[model samples]
Target: MTTTSAFPAANRPVGQVIVRASHVELYRDGQEVLRDVDLEVAKGEILGIVGPNGGGKTSLLRLILGLDRPSSGEIELFGEPVSRFREWHRVGYIPQHAVAFDPNFPATVRETVLLGRVAPRGVFHWFRPEDFAVARSATELCGLSGLEGRRVGALSGGEKQRVFIAKAIASRPDLLVMDEPTAGVDPESERRFYDLLGRLKDELGLTVIFVSHDLGVVSARVDRVACLNRTLVYEGPPRALHDEALLRTLYGGGTVTIAHSEEEPHTHGH
Candidate 1:
């Protein structure tokens, strides 16, 4: 398979850099988690990041979201330094396993999604008519319109995931960052979710950055793929990642298979 161009000039404006990282490094407990990493995310692109567990995938995302600071090097969001960037509403994030919300929480689906609008509405302001409209539209877009009144705890794992996605989309963000959004979802549900994501990307012109251990899904769906293990080892089209030698190098050489089927292939390492 030939590698596809990640940044097609016809789809988006030229030289539109949404996220840029230069020589970024991070340390935790005196141990290096990321080393001299450099990355760029163009507008309207789906960038899939894959690597083994503890390979600093989440760490890199944290730096981008301003959740954590890099020990050295520079990072920028929308051309502004991350530390000074204040336009958080332009970015939406869904953490791994949708862990930000408690499964047993008593909030309804609509109410939970309404939380997303709070950022734009300010810290303590009440939800206005427009806020409710946006939340409802987002819920409908995520196929959760009928379930809006249901308690979040009563929903299944897949439904819960959709609720979170609706919450993210309610913000109307330009960049969407997801950390293992399909972690605990069933196979069928996961497939449906990815399909929805593809549609959403096209309809919203979203720039997505996602981290996943599922190589098959990453290869099939993303415009570009980056293999990170402390440092970036590969960064290009998914077709370029089919090499067995490269797979072994990324996963530490036990066994790796890239499935081209409709479903994601099973892999041993994270």
Candidate 2:
């Protein structure tokens, strides 16, 4: 039975945060994707964004990452306006479908993870001894220990994901944004990957916002579930939003059944 208490809760500031989007709008080549979307993610919480294809899930991630600006509305992260927080180092992102480069990229796993420490951020102006130490620590924490010398392309799906996570955490950001970290992996690998996230959030005190299509399993891992269909449909705890009617509405009429255990209360709605 998985519970929120299975992992240690973050001890950092779980203060009232305003990770809000005020009437946010996004356009791609004159076509509207996300229309007037409003959302918020509190501190010490894992917010899962689930939706069907082309539901603007990736676009929303881009907006929050400051990779792209909204056509309208404002985005605030951690009570501070995103635009004003020039410290991009405060955030980490594991992008969707991120795979290892050419098998001949000529970089070790440790070296690739160290790329997270490369210039321009406050985390490290240059690759210093402290940076190496931090990278080493992150690699170990992500369970990459002795495999640091392995070539990235040679690793399995789960191992590759862990390496990217290590790279992201090497920066030691306050917020970690992961987009579909478990996609395409085997079931065993997928479960292990999520277990790693659980450990990271608890031990490292990082705020996680991940996007996934595996609603059933993902719902069990997060503190809150936020359904988006070009805009916000529902946002609340797993139990509150894990109803068939709500999911059907969000997915636009699809059947979903969730199995529950007597030892662990599970909810499914669609």
Q: All models: lDDT?
A: 0.85, 0.76
Q: Model 1 off-target regions past 4 Å? A: 1-14, 99-101
Best candidate according to lDDT? 1
Q: After superposition, how far is residue 122 of candidate 2 from its true place, in Å?
A: 5.7
Q: Which ten residues in a row have the lowest lDDT in candidate 2?
A: 1-10
Please give each candidate's TM-score. Answer: 0.92, 0.86
Tell me the tens digit of each residue's lDDT in model 2 across 75-112. Answer: 98876777876767768889897754465667789998
Which model scores highest in TM-score? Answer: 1
Worst 10 residues of 1 by lDDT: 1-10
User: Could you give candidate 1's per-residue lDDT for residues 81-164 as a string of tens digits?
Assistant: 999999999999999868446767899998999988989888878889999999999998888979989999889888899998
